[model samples]
Target chain A: MKTSDFRFDPSQVRTGYSHSTIFKEDGFGMNYCSSCGVRVLTQVPEGDHLPRQVCPSCHTIHYSNPKILVGAIPVWERKILLCRRAIAPREGYWTMPSGFMENGETLQMGAARETFEESLARVTIEDLMSVINIAAHNQVHILFRAQMDSPEHGVTLESSEVRFFEEAEIPWADLAFRTVTQALTHFVEDRQRGQRTLHLVDLETTRP
Target chain B: MKTSDFRFDPSQVRTGYSHSTIFKEDGFGMNYCSSCGVRVLTQVPEGDHLPRQVCPSCHTIHYSNPKILVGAIPVWERKILLCRRAIAPREGYWTMPSGFMENGETLQMGAARETFEESLARVTIEDLMSVINIAAHNQVHILFRAQMDSPEHGVTLESSEVRFFEEAEIPWADLAFRTVTQALTHFVEDRQRGQRTLHLVDLETTRP
Candidate 1:
């Protein structure tokens, strides 16, 4: 479909629009909304050149824009909290304790909640790690650089496993999402810029 | 309906499965996809909270999340690019020269395109400004602190009119999006931070 057909009123930015078909043939598959678990509808309407997805309830439209996905950059000593997913798309892949933004929750709260839920490692979020947008998923994932309250806490959520991987040990290939890779990249870049100032908190008093 | 019926995937970070009744009863109106203008569907088979939007044609399901919008902090000499919208939601209110990212465009490209499209002034995007998640529209709007290519170039887009208003001349009450106000706040804050190194570039030529 023509790109212009998909464009809508700027005011519609608040509420998304319905989509027409845009994918080429053989694109049929379970279109998963990473943030919203809706099944993508791919039917192209008449007078449309492309297939698009639209929110059934909210009537908001979807675009391949970057979404703000928040995560924890919790560090204990020289290690950080990482979770192995117990779910699909990339089951068993490692990721920072992170998730998407929720209604009524600030970015800070989202990061904190995800960190605690995934790692059981309570942390007081520090400054931002970096804002990286994964446009393919329409997410602007925010990795908040936090410090853990304790270093010895075990896993809590549906994580297959949890571990404290040192900077050199980060598994770049097995990262759950590109955001983690981006976050780690930023972490290293920032460190090179001399920004890795650990407050040197003891692991004993760090657990919730 | 259960809150799960209006489920949002924290994993993906976008809204899906909102109650269809919410829109029908509240008259919030519907948003359509920009690629193919169609009303996004709402009903699902049953008990599914996957947060998906559907297309009528091509029958391809496409998943979408929140979008990240970037803006330019147009500064000319001691003035900036500000406008009064001639449209709705905030009719006649003031806002920055900003728009959404088109497909296949970079964040910086979108910013530059939007700034000139809305204000008619070309600029060289510079440093990053503070990023904010505009939850009201399910967008993460990033406002970059930018520099005008020519101080004398005027605005050319949907603005009621354009002007390089000085800080003291800013019409605070008439300001539009919270991001605009916030950007202005940061501008003042940066000045107070005592970092007054405004990069100067000679305007080789001018544009109408």
Candidate 2:
């Protein structure tokens, strides 16, 4: 399935739709108040250092924070599963099954759910692999090492192609995002060292 | 420095202001659209599984996800620093310094910021201690172990009292949040075992 299938209105196309632009627009582009429908003013609320979209009528200060993206690297028979994106922000590039985390779910649950959604593969979420902080884009990517329940996997709406790759066959240059590369690299290195370690990375740039 | 000091209007009081209720209201209590000033309707958008607050006029779907609370367990000379909250939901209860993670900051930066905000102590954030998913409240609490830069510390507006506490002297009964309790327990246990291991906990209930 294409990413446009997820959007309700196709005509309102967002040009240059990178992840940073999408998050910035969704997070800070509040024109009216959600509580009272009044046009909100961009000002610093009392005792607040940062300016927020504050409603003058209802005295409500709307806050926007960084979002978390949960994902997992699924391993089956010593091969890692990857999904080729059917979406934008680097379409057709391979990445571990991941997406924005939903509410009312644990990190493990989100990872497993994203894996199933993208690759059509059921996985048991394992230990935390990497916690990448993309502070510039206001996103935190959390990835886990997962064990595939079975070898059964197929393409889904979010992924046009799904397949397993050995360590030597990983398409290093065609990875979708920097966080994906970081997680996959760490996974490979730790496996070679005969250890499982959690990596915390702070990515300062948007370069992939 | 009561919690009311943070609010602009004290008369608009939230009765029985627990963490779950606060998050529930903040995460799902949308009435009007933020994009357009029209009243939003609760409906499932096309190809969406869950109901969302969707704007009829502008076709903007407001997605609410779980929030991240970044905190630090500050240690100075074999003693842990704790803060007595001056706010509601657990006023006067002891807790490690913590608050909502902000935009444009890494997890370590947020942990240190909250540590200084509540306890007035500058700290160098260390390894991740615990990641507790409070899914029932639509929140995830990430705690880190930190080393104090100096012995200097004081109380802040968020905390009525702040001081160092030995493991035996920690007031277990007066601790504020369950996530805090879990993190502290893990910290003490890991220190005793002479190993630093990250703890991942999924708290199903709101019981403190």
Candidate 3:
């Protein structure tokens, strides 16, 4: 996979440690202060338990926390929407539409935006389906249960194609992100029981 | 009400806009490169939506997002745990044992740690009770349902007092944060219903 892949196809699912996972492993002790553009000193900030990237020049402490990834598990009747990736890490693989949440947006807003951007689908994003923490990417994946506004929209520029699949039609082995698979599985089981309860799952042990 | 109050009592419930609220209200265009101590220019980085604090000296983009706050509702019998705050915005008011989530920890880990730190109590934190988006504060509050290991512990250094409150005993008017009251109310209602389903609430209406 190359960095260029993410530029054109930024809607791909978050995988292993890129920024968040690495930072969580250690102090995320990255050098160079974005504040003062100087080499930052990594140390336990006074009276704080965790060591942060403290700027000696301006005294601004840099904190690293898990990023939130919001998306929609689009469903029209029994069919669930899927996006085929054109990016690396899982190019040609299928998964739910999701990406790193930007600043200054609610989880729902982010989910709606990502869905529209990835699949060009106008979805009525509904209740929270699952909140899965992907430790590998230092990301919290929050997927919403949604239905098509009218009909499924066109294929977005971010994906190779957009389609829907029922339980038996899902590409389980060819899914892009692990959280997508877990969410889809939950949807299937919950649909079988005729319910949509919120699921909170930790994907720490699900990694290869 | 003083800043020093936060030092020893950092576990107070989130009330009005503090640091995060103000930052979110604006673009948080504060510059001054963390690396070189130079002023960072506000401009759209490559393939980005909103403008970010980009340090020209070090060429680093500073991205900021709303933070997560996690805590647990400590229950013993029918009473829920409450902590007296010594911090500003609602000093001396009662609230749940919650705090700003720290880096390098899972949501559950942060909730457990905050519970232990604020009340010195050992709780078996269980499923997520409520995940609220406090838009005014630009924060997400994730509350869990937990049972006291034995009995409720003593007052923590971060609290003026630690005690339990039944439905009628809850100090509604004296609550430190709006989000706290909502979570506790849910627990009370859910307890009455003989079930505790996960609640995904957006407490935007509760804001001033």
Please give each candidate's TM-score.
0.63, 0.87, 0.82
Higher-ranked by lDDT: 1 or 2: 2
Candidate 2 TM-score, C-alpha based: 0.87
lDDT of 2 by residue, B16-63 (tens): 234344346446788899888899987768866556788999898998
Q: Score candidate 2 by DockQ.
A: 0.27
The model with the greatest TM-score is 2
Write one digit per residue (lDDT tens) for candidate 3, span A87-129: 7878899989887665445666667777777887767667787
Cα distance off (Å), candidate 1, residue B29: 7.8
- Report RMSD (Å) for each prediction in the order shown: 12.7, 11.1, 10.6
iRMS of candidate 3, Å: 13.9
Quick one: best DockQ, which candidate? Answer: 2
Question: What digit string (tens of lDDT, one per residue) describes model 1 on residues A1-208?
Answer: 0011111123332122223211321222325332344445544334322344544544434434334457777789868678889877688899888876543344665677677667777777666556553333333456667778778556554588989888888899899865577677777667778874211110111111
**In terms of lDDT, which candidate is strongest?**
2
